[model samples]
Target: MASQEKIKLVLLACGSFNPITNMHLRMFELARDHLEDTGRYKVVKGIISPVGDGYKKKGLVEACHRLEMARLATESSEWITVDDWESQQPEWVETAKVVRHHHAEVLSSENNSNGDDVDTGKYRKRRKMEKKSPSCMNPKADRPHLNLLCGADVLESFGVPNLWKPEDIEEIVGRYGVTCITRCGSDAEKFINQSDVLYKHRKNISVVREWVTNEISATHVRRALRRGQSVRYLLPDSVVRYIQDHSLYSAESEQKNAGVILAPLQRYSKTE
Candidate 1:
């Protein structure tokens, strides 16, 4: 059996890994490297959410297709995974439940070690971490750990009142700590001000502003591909291949002829 992945700290870098690119890798690297350097987390992994059955985008393809693409891109990286719980959910009502599930999975794995076959290298790294950092033990216990991932654009109204109740949103963020990544324009402060219930109750919001790297988003990648331009380097090669193979992100007009454009998924998660 595949040695169950060591689950330590859960850094939910949730996003619509539409095609899964190298930039995603960079982001994963950034999170892992940061956590490793500062001893902030144990196992920080990225969760890709491709909209499942419940939703639909004008030109978007099927949920399974997107999910497959994400999986394909992340095949090599043990730190990243394509989580379908949210994607496959019939509605957003199950968001909090899923968050708790992820948390339980992490904690349970740490407590229940299955066998004696341990990677000596991983063992050494764990030993070094334990020896050097007092904060490493029960890593989740004392530290202000929510989900640590960064985001650039955050809109308060993105939460459609009809679609999601405030309590629902609150439960997800509250249940699992959210370490927000802020880039300037995200109306973040407004969200905090408006979200008095979640924000005020928590000890302190965990947010960080690392350098805002390339602003080129998934949209840009699609546009470039549709125009027969190069989106290379901006996004990882895997994403490019998947998009090409699946023919995602064609021009708005081409979408009609091509059948599906791909999910218009602005999948808003706790962190992205």
Candidate 2:
């Protein structure tokens, strides 16, 4: 009997990450655990890549700020790391390009003898062709398998017009694979089946249903902050402190009122 070869799996989570939340980090862990349980993959790394300012999403903070906040959120986690490549891009590169770049980086670092880097050139050529040919089923074994990680909400939006190109969807779901963490009331299978391309490559899509929901979203957190409410446990302590020190999200008047409210509590606590 021969021992099965260990498959190195890396996850690239690209998004606004305007302010990294617990839910964002949780998806990585959920995906890693689910993949590892299959006994076919060894999850090595998870990279959180914030979208560049080129995305122009409303309420999106500066790329530098988002990058630092992500760093702070994941600094203590050993396997999870933050990548600024996407954040630093002068123009908004498509998600497929971001995934490919990271995959290339992984292959280059491994120094695999099987010409993993050469395959990237082939990928570029494939992108240029018009015909919808299925990508290579068997990629270089030595190269780590890189996949995109996102919430089910994102998965459902793939079919929306003007959001994702057909070629990009094929490449992302077909070539790179995706792990979608299911949100409450989201039917990933239904959405996948609705799209001809997504359905064809549905095998590459892994949907992990989350039973215990943590409905913590960046929007909700921002709203709470704006309303001068406590968001202590919703995010990591370091992230919370960063938000406080940097005065992010909260309106100027709200922050001033919050300070006034906290001063008395601070003084009373100090006396005790």
Candidate 3:
């Protein structure tokens, strides 16, 4: 039986999403099923936040295209929505900040639903002085919990040197928690056990094993697209059509843009 009062939760996935793949969308469903099965949490929303062009990673496409592809991929889902806040930013925002921003938005929405005016100043002050548990809000309250949804690879990236701040890890895992959707052959649990911070907050991390393994990734999709191979089912039809229409990831386009550094504004334009 379901709990009488289940904690409301929102799932946030932040990434390059160069071209959002089917696996990226399936992660939300896997996490929702895993969490709701526990009878303690109900996933209320799923948000996909694509990184801005400032990340400057290899094989990363324009933020606008990635944002649009994400929106198109999730347009049919009732619970999933695309947030452009991170993508529209002038530079890449930290993952912890993005999660916190979404949490505040959730709290603001809950307040608005009850006809209460959100006092921004008071909220900021409270957050600054918060010394309690990870979640600054009362667990018994009706507020929704915002958890970061990520793949096992990202979870392991916590060990990458200088890639993530220790404090940011605490803020994200301690405050909001994480719902990691792990694929087959991944050693997600082993990684968690090896980290001191992750081990300390182990309860806050929930790992959902994806039984029906899928290895579809954006890098592979881009490669196939560049070589003129079929990617009909690897991604949504709408997204595939969008890529074709804009000639994205084509050999010509890739060669033309290869090794060329573009400014933030220049990176937002679609491929010719």
Candidate 4:
């Protein structure tokens, strides 16, 4: 499905990058290596959908700020590309449409089109733009063999993608692939069971097991930030500093447990 214009792949990560952390980068790093080891080699495909902006998830600054930071955080990595599509989508659609978009492109080739009506010169430029533009060029799948990345909690919430429905998620995952960096034991099972329904794409649902990031959590980093302690070992240093720079969960809150602070806010601040 590739043309002389561009070589594309999707490396997806979904989460409340509430302010992305180092663990997030580490996860990506591991993801690339894991894919290479398996011979897929295009490990650094690109992030399809990422989580950001919510009430209880109360992003410290805002989505735009978070997106800028993410751009800065992964600016240096060739393998990383941000799909701000999810954050920008008003009602985030199922990841399947995005996956289907990729697949459609793959299923169809650029030059494969019938050349009867179109001018050759304009067509060449349009094909060029398709490679560089982040937006889907064709109405079909660009890279149908999509793989989504997420943590244990997000993986556990796989069934709940219904929250975004009438957009079906399981069907979407069935179309592409589900690559998870697992934490919870239950989600590991859920990912497997869900694959059964997707018998067609079962091989695509792969797990990038993590013994390294097992204990990493955004809530934990937020707690450390509030205590004015070093969260150096937790999230990415860039992320820690970004949180501090923005005064997110800083010592001013005097709240030791981030969960308590975020939870009571839901009960106390109904307008949120």
Question: Model 4: per-residue lDDT, tens digit, 108-174?
Answer: 5433544323346765565456445423323243332446666656555544422333234554454
Q: Provide the overall lDDT of each model, using Cα atoms, as 2-decimal numbers.
A: 0.54, 0.79, 0.84, 0.55
Candidate 2: where is the Cα deviation over 4 Å? 1-4, 112-136, 251-272
Candidate 1 residue-wise lDDT, 27-76, digit = tens: 66665565555444455456655555444434455567678777877788
Query: Best by TM-score, which number?
Result: 3
lDDT of 2 by residue, 1-272 (tens): 11246578899999988689988999999999898887767889999999987765656677888888899999889999999998898867788889889877776566445544545767457444412433224433544678899999999888655666678888999888999999987899899888899899888888998888998888788889888899888888888898889888856522323323222233335654
A best-first ranking of the candidates according to their lDDT comes to 3, 2, 4, 1
**Model 1 worst lDDT run, 10 consecutive residues:** 257-266
TM-score of each: 0.67, 0.82, 0.88, 0.64
Worst 10 residues of 2 by lDDT: 256-265
Give residue 100's lDDT in candidate 2 (0 to 100): 80
Cand. 1 Cα-lDDT: 0.54
- Give the per-residue lDDT digits (tens) of candidate 3, residues 1-272: 34647888999999989899999999999999999999888889999999987776667778889999999999899999999999888876788889989988887887778776677776556545543544524566456788899999999989875667788898888888888988666789999999999998888899999889999988889899988899999999999999999889866544544565543324324321
Candidate 1: segments with Cα more than 4 A from true spot: 1-7, 33-40, 89-94, 114-160, 187-190, 201-204, 252-272
Output the better candidate (1/4) by TM-score.
1
lDDT against true structure, model 4: 0.55
